[model samples]
Target: MTVTERRATTRAAPGPRPAQPPRAVAVGVPRLLYVLALAGLALLTLPVLALLVRADWPGVPAAITSPEALSALGLSLRTALAATALCLLLGVPLAVVLARTPTRAADVVRALVTLPLVLPPTVGGIALLYLLGRRGLVGEQLDLLFGIRIPFTTTAVVIAQAFVALPFLVIALEGALRSAGDRYEVVAATLGAGRWTVLRRITLPLAAPGLVSGTVLCFARALGEFGATALFAGNSAGVTRTMPLAIYTAFNGAGVTQDSAVALSLLLVVVAVVILVLARAWKPGGRG
Candidate 1:
């Protein structure tokens, strides 16, 4: 090496060593927390396990396939689907309003919309009755104008289910909308897109995942609806008798046996499980 080069190399200090990244911490959960978690899990799971164990596995197929059971299942599916549709129709607009608007009145409206989630289902049924029963204010006007009956009917069942399930759809969609923010929507507006176009093309597409999840939750809640349905629609055979109602009937009614109730309960559980699994597996249209 040249003397000048050697002198320069010796004069310069070595570059600072590259900084090492910090190591991740290893967390140790307390034993008490583990015990409590296990206890809570057991509390939630043991009853379902007991029901499964109590069910007459050999008789389940025959019991659930009987004419009465089949009718109830069919009615439940129809009403639940109808209710889910209703929730989607009404909930999307409501969620949009709630997510976009920032006002006290909007907060009150949101609370009112979700009130049924905390209210007892039976109270909801009574409220429905007061609002739509034959003697009700709206019902009386409807009957006077069109001779329409509201209570103790298939329509009533759908309304009851929708009433109870609407909150789930609204909450989910609102959260999704809030998380998605208004960036794309603002850009669309700047580009001269109309409100409806922005909603249809950008907002709805972005929130599709939440919409699917909310729809599934609403459908499941509707499928298991009982107290509101019973009080508002009545548990008539092949009519308002949904699976939950049928299970209740079979357990208490003189015509059906407890074994049938157990079978129907198992069927409902299986259906719920399948829906949850499908919801988890579902991928939104635009998600990566």
Candidate 2:
């Protein structure tokens, strides 16, 4: 063999050529979707932005500190928190049942649990009134036996909020329970753990993320509840009136302009955003 040929044969083959960068795909559809998403985001953000813009800085502190406003805020916070607690207490079990059960009734139960999500808040108020208002179904018995009427009171506010928010918690916890495989529960059973022990030790811990997320979402929804709260509870300072009711009052009150209403709305928005941020930050790996 020639020396040059021999030398070339001895040399290692050249490494594979570096891969070419991927080419951009057609732009029309993607660009359109991006623009649409941005538009939707902007639309969602516009009301909050307008509220902030129209706020009267000098008037805000006074408005917020006013007795009526303070009372409504307090009531709102108290009722919302109570409702959230109730939702967590009841929703977690219902979610577990929905996730674990395989009976034909399970589907029906799940649908019933989620019915409040689609039911109009005003309709929920009416339903609650029918069931619990003075002279209504259970209300008459409660009043006759215990002297307790449920409607047009703080309890009504809580019930209304819970009615609306429970569905959120149920859906979230159900998804979490479903996503968390049954292997851990099986392992716990094999290890001689009881059903409740397995749930408490293995299932609950694994579903913590979903449970926390659902609780936060439920709290947020309860905080902003308006229609059912207003319809069933009625506006009563330090009793049933909440922030949203106060906003309505301010909007409708003579000599109170839309700017004032906007300012109050901005305050609600800020509180909601802070809650969401905290909820996200509290998660182990940040919110998904």
Candidate 3:
């Protein structure tokens, strides 16, 4: 080797080495924290366990199959399904917009979109009523032009459910989109793919895990909607009443017994548990 190359290699070898990060220190969890966490868990779960303890297990079938119960269950399922469909239709596009927009504008839009999540159900119901009631802003115009009434109808049930559930899908899908980054989209665009093609092929596929979990959450939330549905749609048996409304009615001694309410409540609890299990399965690194 030449003398110059030898000298350069020797100089480089004696240069300062790069710094290494310190190792993580293992910290022990406090016993108090553990105790508090256990308490919190119990606080959330005890009510459900108590409900099971009191439920009329043998009478569940009879209560669930009663004509009114059947009508409420059917209505709940149908409306929840419709609400979920509506969520997927509008929420996907809104999520994409939130994902791609500038930070400031996105924050504003996201806040507005997620408002209903924190808003009380009764407040939401009241707001919906004012906006869509026969004498309301847009409702009055509709009444004059098309003679269409919105509140206290089966359609109001769907609207209330969708209003509350939309944020679940939007928040989930947006998180997925942000995590996925824009690398693939940039490549697709450079390859001459249009925005629609890129979204259809790359964005949605990458966000599939979030989409599945979001859809499940949306459906579950819609299924359990009560205050909004009660206020906006009323408690019409064949048209508007859902399982939660039925349970509320029975609990208040309108016509059905407390046993029937407990049974229907158990059914809802079961549906919630199944949905949570399904959601866990669709998480990014989950079993499914």
Each prediction's number of clashing residue pairs: 0, 0, 0
lDDT of 3 by residue, 93-117 (tens): 9999999996898899999999999
lDDT of 1 by residue, 1-288 (tens): 999999899889698799999999999999999999999999999989999998888888899899998999999999999999999999999999999999999999999998999999999999999888888879878888999998999999999999999999999999999999999999999999999999999999898888889999999999999999999999899878999999998999543389889889989999999999989988976433
Angstrom error of the Cα, residue 22, model 3: value is 10
Spell out the clash pairs found in candidate 1. Answer: none
Full-model lDDT for every candidate = 0.93, 0.87, 0.92
Candidate 1 error regions (>4 Å): 1-19, 253-256, 286-288
Best by lDDT: 1
**lDDT by residue for model 2 over 1-288, one digit each (tens)?**
999998887786676899999999965667789889999999998867777777888888777777877787788889999999999889999999999997889999989988988999999989988888887899889999999988888999999999999999999988998999799899889989999899898898888889988999999999999999888999887889899988998899655555566667877888899999988878644544
Q: Give the TM-score of each candidate.
A: 0.91, 0.88, 0.87
Candidate 3 stretches with Cα past 4 Å from truth are: 1-26, 254-256, 282-287
For model 3, the run of ten residues with the poorest summed lDDT: 278-287
Model 3, C-alpha of 83: deviation from truth (Å): 0.5
Cα-based lDDT at residue 265, candidate 3:
94
Clashes of 2: 0
Decoy 3 TM-score against native: 0.87
The local lDDT score (0 to 100) that residue 66 gets in candidate 1 is 95
